[model samples]
Target chain A: MGNVAYAVLSSDEQEVSIMEKKIQWETELVHALQRSKVEKRPILLDFHNPH
Target chain B: MDTVTYPQQSVVTFIEHNLIPLRVGSDTQPLASDFAVTWTPTLVLLDPQGKEHHRTVGFFDAEALIPSLLLGLGKVEYDSNKFKEALGYLEKLLAEYPESDSAPEAIFLTGVNRYKSTGNPLPLKEAYEQLQRMYPASTWTKRAYPYRLLG
Candidate 1:
């Protein structure tokens, strides 16, 4: 059931819930693909210009 | 996208439910050079092996984004030869977001997915007809022009 990996943004339980409600973005492509394979889900890779 | 699209509740939920979201700076490392990042907000869908199935360069609002991602997921399944699974995603996109920018392409792929799964060319012809009737000016309609002769 717990197949998807969540990126923990905060340690607080309340903050964790709030974070979970948002898109959990993984920073590393390698890590993202690893989770993707395990979950059998595709990866939505967004390359944004931070400027 | 950060300021507008991604923050939308529907977009967040859709993405969280179906995809592994990865965010990276365009200028970030080997990936930038590998994927050829010459622009901002380039969204690419990759299989777990890092094979790209679909890509959209530039911006897409929440309405457009959902269908595009659905098409990508369908493409991923199509590429993997999972025709039934591909149809599931493509059909959902067409049924839910038929007026979206991604709809024409979804229709085109839905036809192809149907043909591949059933070994029937009739679906391809029907796809062309549907595209002609629904989106006569779409590029997908043009792309499926040859499919019109499939019957």
Candidate 2:
């Protein structure tokens, strides 16, 4: 949620975006999918009981 | 999960580096029903287009979780027919976390991916042999049981 940080993996531009100090987890699927597409990364969708 | 697993430094870094994370309650409408999730702590890996490639129902510690995610990433690539990319992730998982519970399945997928990419049955045979020798009790070994005849 803060400044977006990035680390380059190689010259082929396999750069990865680094999250904030803590994981900035999106609560909605639509938004997360948007980020997934933009970031070109997979989505780790987690479902918890929330009890 | 919230208190224990997510806060781990390694997990945080790994997720930050490789994945887009979405957190939802099991009761969240439509989403939960769409995914057919009947249990808590279920983790699913989806491609950028939102197609699910891998999923696990249960909890995992930091040690086990990373390899599982790698496997999921490999599956995502595999689903897209990017066998070489998938193999990269699988190879990383096997090399780095060989002892993790996800290892057997990684070995299984590695074999399948190798076969898919190379059209050669030898890798399948090798995968079965490796699984038999290293993880004889693993269900993955049994799943690859038929590959023993691929000589």
**lDDT of model 1 at position B11:** 97
Clashing pairs in 2: none
lDDT per residue (tens digit) for residues A1-51 in model 2? 479897647744443324325788999999998999898999999999978
Against the reference, the lDDT scores of all candidates come to: 0.92, 0.91
- What does candidate 2 score on TM? 0.88
B68-151: candidate 1 lDDT, tens digit per residue: 999999999999999999999999999999999999999999899899889999999999999999999999999999998887
Summarize candidate 2's per-residue lDDT along B1-151 as a digit string, tens digits: 7787898878999998999999999999999999999998999999878889999999899989999999999999998889999999999999999999999999999999999988998999999999999999999999999999996
For model 1, residues A1-51, the per-residue Cα lDDT tens digits are: 479877755569767566646788999988998999999989999999877
Measured by TM-score, the strongest candidate is: 1
Question: Where in model 1 is the C-alpha error above 4 Å?
Answer: A1-20
Worst 10 residues of 2 chain B by lDDT: B1-10
Tell me the lDDT of model 1 at B33: 94
